[model samples]
Target: MMLRTIKRLSSRPVHILGLSTYNYSHNSTLSYRKLTTSASSQTIKREEQAETATVKKEEPDEEKPKLSTMLNLDRAQMEKDRLARLKRKKSDDSHVPQAKHIKTLATQTLTFKKEESVDPLPEPSTSRRGPFMTLRDLQERVASYVPRHTQYLDGVVKKTYVEGRERTPNDIKLEEVFQKDTLQTAVLSAYVWEFLWVLQKLNVGECDLVLVLHAKEDEMVHHYRRNLCNIPRTRLCFPNMSGNVNCMHSKLQLLFHLTYLRVVVPTANMTPYDWGEALGTGRSEGVMENSVFIIDFPELPKTSATPDSNPSHTHFSRQLLHFCKAKGLPADIIEKLDKVYDFSRSKPLGFVYSIGGSHHGTEALKNGVCGLATAVRDLGLKTKKPMEVDYVTSSIGSLNKEFLLRMFRALHGDDGKISVQGIPKKYSSRQLAEPAAAADESTESESEEEDQSDNKLWQDIRSSVRVYFPSRRTVAASKGGIQNGGTICFQRKWFNSSTFPQSLLHDCQSVRRGMLMHNKALLT
Candidate 1:
């Protein structure tokens, strides 16, 4: 026992929980030793108290001002204020029922205010980014900078003309332009107001409105009802659909009555808009597009020929009539197209279409573009500075080198001077600058020997290819918004063979320059 005690004295003594190692003070030791409550909380409180004491000793003492003293107020008045606050808080607790009643009344009154006066609605979907900006913010403020596209949706709805831009949507005043005895009209569009508004403005009291079957048709119709001053006597046409994937993407205003047919193809769901309107500040105006209002009437030939003289040379009006008939159009309109309109004489151009989404992928480019190309070739017009064919559009598709090769081939053929220029409103400004440098390099790199290869036509077409890109503004002073520059490129080259009758949809990685384009038109 004596030896063990000696050993214990010589060696180090071990405290429970290694408290001696921590060098805990007496207060800390007591706080941790308490078993009735959590040691952690007690220790924390002790530490806090010690820190607060230290802080108090270190702080300099100055004359602290009371709320009343700071404002040069009297103590009695400050006391009264404190008492009033307490009284107000006590009253608040007692009058809870009345306060609730007042809140309910306030809510009811607020319901009467116009909704637009309220905060803007939450974004419809987090997934969707805003439509692509085509210009830099700074460029938008440049009064003289020409835009590739114009923002004319406001004009379309207001039916007012904005200066320094394209003609108004109702520039010709369709109501005044067309003769009496209104035509049997067939309108294709996604927006009902765009369709109905134009029809009403044209004095079309009765007509057919064609819609691509969509899930939100019910809501859209409800909204359209609010837009219209009078409910139009409309015959709605939803083309026969086998699946949800396909839609009637074509936008056309086909009117026929009493030996005449007129076709108006506008971009953006036939919204009454000006094709030549100047792009405003901070709007998409990087590129230009082509558009036209097509009007044609059946002309009787001096030589006698039946309405269906040759299926090959069937007039544009007749072809339109055929398209309607194939779709099982309403009997009344069909009757008018069949009897009233003559289809003997040929027009300068006709509308071409693809039946399904797959059709756009294949036949649309071929038939539509190639047909135009063939027509251009037939024109035999000579120009020293290659003929400039333009495409102004809103929609683009996945285009690739091969598809472009095919297209250029179809358009250019042996004609070296044919240069195709496209300006999609979304990428107008940035793409405008692309063609100059890229085209020169690309054209220089290719060899003429390749002309003898299988893709001779494509090679020839690539020779004269050029695209346009515009200068983007960096910032906008008026809106304080960052508008991004535009870009263009194609993804796939699914098209291998050039088909006749091209449906020209703009597509490219290298974009082109344009001035206030966006009306869907093919101008040769």
Candidate 2:
């Protein structure tokens, strides 16, 4: 019975030390032995198999697949919600109102701030790194250097024509030139800062203003409104221009008085720099000098007829009307001036202008080079000799052989006789008298001969012509140096061209040696 009990105990699974031998009781005679029997072995194997199965099941829960991708869709969804909330908050805040006075001032301040920041001032190519300067600051700097009392217009008071190095004689301030109460209205045209400086110069606050400028319609209006808001009445006129037209480069002023209308054509712009303003100190002074042609036309009597109908209508008056008409000025203004003013006094002075257009036939003889021809003819200038031509200028265009030739021909009061379709028709009567074939052949031969003659004449004219401009050396050594010469430009491509007359080029040595010249003049 004891043996049976031992065998039964061994058949059951061992709890301690796995399957190792152990003595359960000290009194028992049966020796401990390995539990290698089939029943015991089967029981031990079944327990181990159950433990491994459990471990396998738990491992799958802890370990994850390495190739699996994590999703961030929820994060993206949260970010979108955050942005939507921010937009709603901003919209809600915008509906809130503020005090009226504070709001008005704030709005104006913001408007100006925004405007000032919109257009970035370009840094000059030659400018070095430094603290930035605003346009207003630059204007003040330029104005500071100018002499306070530049004009001494009393010619009889000053008999000596020459003033010392620092002083200028016979100077006239634009502001002092106009009579205060007598000035009724004014017309002003210039290159830069037209409204700002000119309005103060004229001192015609109550007068009606007619401003001619070159800019887009909206831009021009905005500029005028920004600068001249206090003016009582204003009119803006743009020169009639096409894509090929370069610029509206004329500077003119018209002042209407109680008894007369005064016209002043000046070589200077509205800026202080162009009107006897210097950029240097003491003896080494840089000056911008310009000349003016001023004329006063008397108001006609009421008994006289309109200028168009009157026999006394001078060439200058007719041309002025034509120019106004071409530039798209107010018809009523032109008519009023024509009817009221007598321009007979202006006959002694010649008005030369360049209006942009592709004019043909006889109409070509009315402006630009052709207009110069007309002026020379009217003035009765003798051009029979081989005339020497000298031209001084601040700006140079893309000059070519053809342009120089035409200019030479124009100076001699000739049409240049270029072969264009409509121009030949001006003398079509001569062609009509001959047979059709003969006329065509004769015209061709005549044109060829004329061209040869023109080529020969061009060679002679080219040799005699000279152009004076500020060279690099001249500009660098000036009182203001290269910075003030920004307005003068001549492209390298034009100068480098084969057809450019390089031999005739000369440096413009101003009388005031250190001063830069912004003058444009032609001498024959």
Candidate 3:
């Protein structure tokens, strides 16, 4: 029984070893399969993660450009809003009441005083039997009355004899020569009185007259008026020794109404040719040998002067005395004269004559203007109220219009129809008309060029665009939101479905081209 048990135990050992080996092989196969499966799953997961990371990186690149575009649009919108606000503020400020005072002052009229005195002169009866006087008649009247002797020629007499009196058995003096003293007396007695009558008829009250004299024979008339009319001479004289004086005259008719008078005199040694050129071409036509005159009316009072209790007769006498001393005249002459008549209290009607006065330079002209202004001011002060001063520099064209206007405003308070309102309107109209006329010419040219260019550009752009109709399938696909389609398919299905007329296409192209060109021009 021992031998048989040993044999069975050895066989059982062999069986147990075989079973252990089989179990080990099964466990090894299961572990190898699990390792391979796990490695494959990990590799798949890594590939998927890398693909997702790549997609995310590419998405930001596309979104970055879109973000930049959005930012630019926001900035443009903000700038537009800022400009709009500024425009609104400017518009609001313009409506405020600040320019109204200037407007009111610019439209005020000038004020003048009423005349108080009248001379007991006989009025002339109107006669309609005579024809109107011609230029020849005026020439004849001037030649017959004015003396041949002139101060300008230093007392030289120029004569023209009548026809057929050149040679004779006994040569007779054809031209008549009168003594200076006799001529002066005659002018003072007859011509001056007539001139004064003309002045008195105008009713200009207590104004100064400017008499321009050039040692010409015509100046004798002015001298006679000055000596006989008893007008006082102002201390101021023109720089050029032109025979001219500014006499105080009260009325316009007295100074400007004479058709035969030579009102303006040039003392600057200018010939007729030179004078013609200086004045302007074509101005010398029909100019006769006549004298020039300016009737400068005194300024009305802006504010009244305080009258002295004693009327300061001493000051008045002293001023007269000084004037006499300066002119080297005897003060007793004034004393011997009778006080003919006093119009306004302490204010005498006077005249000034400038013999060879030349207001050429800036300083001389300024002084002339200032002297006139002061004279007007003194008259205004006498009245004790605000007044207007009218400045008529010369009836002749020798005076500068701009300079005269400036002088007028400087003397007056720039408050009158002639000063602030009337003059500015005339000047502004001239200033505005020039630019407006020029702009009209340029605008017409530019508008025509722009229209032609726009038409050409529109024709070119219209030729480049292509359009077509879409199929039913493409339309159905687009309606289903299908993404797989060409741009042509989408455009044909939606945009080209509607037939655009030739007129409409042309208009759209034209508008687009015009808008593009306009924007480009503005940017440039």
Candidate 4:
């Protein structure tokens, strides 16, 4: 075809062809250029078609199905229907007896079957078996029984918190005593859940009941009316409460009868969690707490104890009486308490508690870092006696440098805070000093002679101003061999182990896996 086109162009005029072909040497040159142009155009068209096909392949116009198309959809549907039908048949056959004879009688009538009761969640364990004594075991060992010189009180010494065992609902024997003497009165501070559970457990049916309760009036509280209906017996109290922040935060359990009076100060609440019913999480995987129990076996039935005979009891009675009176106890309960324990007869023990109101917090703060001379006299530590202030607590955050020094100065007549974490490395020492300045001679003399009785066995406390707190290792470990009792542990540790105190402290190596702790307590 090219040759035919060249022949036809050859017959044309050279100048005419030259003008048409521009600068072509021959008409065949024009034919060859056309041929090359046509070939190049065809090649470009083929490349463009290839590029368009690749783009279309890379980008899908529509989405694909998620489930496998190869699956047997019909078979799966049939299987599901068959399972549903079998479930329905099972439900229908449930009423019919398995025996053929009994199945025939199913058309007559069948009684509804009752379901078995499901058990509630298990409670957390407060105490696990240990081969040796933790500070807790030592604390229990040192705590003395209350209502001494009485049949019940003496037997109670062994049954008290001395065993280092977890507290149980039935562990409290006061329940039986209260039930027996229907005239006995009992007062407790608790959360609603705890109160209800305790009330149910104690079996204290309307015999005198005074409760200091804490809990919000939520939907659950309304639903649990069987217990909430008895709200009349409780004097409502809450902490961080909207109406009142410091509204009766004290956890006191007082049982009063004409014959005797029992006092229990527990760090734990009435809830199962407090009594090791709820397992802890995170840092509190293992929990520990401190508690104090005082049984004032009144010198009733016949007068045995007197103002001087049992000064410790008298002092405790006075403090407790003051607390109750200030708490605005019921007139009847107050009257009953007065008949047994007379505050006038109580011996004075120097202990200033932190109470409600800004004034109290301020006073606590002021007392924290200052007023050493007065506290020394108040605590009845002979200014001349080598006495030092030792602070052993579960929560270290409760004390700081400025505050600790002030407390030590007040108790030991010196000043300083030590360096444990951010604390300084200086401790206050209580050297022989001049007489402590006190409010009155009567107050000084009153606090003086009583502590002597207990001190008869040992010398005065000479431990310096030292703050003990849980270490980082203790918090991380799951071991609960350390005492949660704040400063109380020091007294218990020393008092009980005066004979072999180190034995208890060292026992952790054999038992609790070593001195690991929580609750921030800095003890064995």
TM-scores for all candidates: the values are 0.42, 0.61, 0.19, 0.43
- Report the Cα RMSD per candidate: 26.4, 33.0, 50.3, 30.8
- lDDT at residue 90 of model 3 (Cα atoms): 38
lDDT of 3 by residue, 296-325 (tens): 222113242232222223222333333333
- Which regions of candidate 1 are displaced past 4 Å? 1-196, 199-232, 240-247, 257-259, 272-290, 298-315, 326-328, 344-350, 357-390, 412-458, 467-515, 522-524
- Please provide, for model 2 over 111-151, each residue's C-alpha lDDT reduced to its tens digit, 9 standing for 90 to 100: 74344322222222222212233455344434442222322
Q: Which stretches of candidate 3 lie over 4 Å from their true place?
A: 1-332, 335-344, 348-367, 380-394, 413-524
Global lDDT scores for all candidate models: 0.36, 0.55, 0.25, 0.35
Task: Give the alpha carbon lDDT tens digit for every residue of 161-252 in model 4.
Answer: 21133434323333333332222467776432344345434423323567665444554333444434433334432323334443344667
Candidate No. with top lDDT:
2
Residue 179 of model 4: what lDDT?
A: 31
Question: Across residues 1-524, which tens digit of lDDT does each residue of candidate 1 receive?
Answer: 00010001222321221111212233432121111222344443343235322322211111111111212233354334444543553354543232233334445534632232122222211121121212442233243322222212112222222223344344332332232223445554442223423443432332334433222355644544443323234545555444453455555555543334555554433333332223333243222233335445452443544444433244355556655664556777666555554344434444454343222222222234443443345444323344445543433455445456535544444222222222222332233343555545544443333334436544443454433222123122111122321212122342332441223332322212223333444444
- What lDDT score is found at residue 154 in candidate 3? 16
Off by over 4 Å in 2: 1-171, 176-181, 217-229, 278-286, 306-308, 416-446
**In model 2, how large is the Cα lDDT of residue 250?**
75
Candidate ordering by TM-score (highest first): 2, 4, 1, 3
Candidate 4 worst ten-residue window by lDDT: 61-70
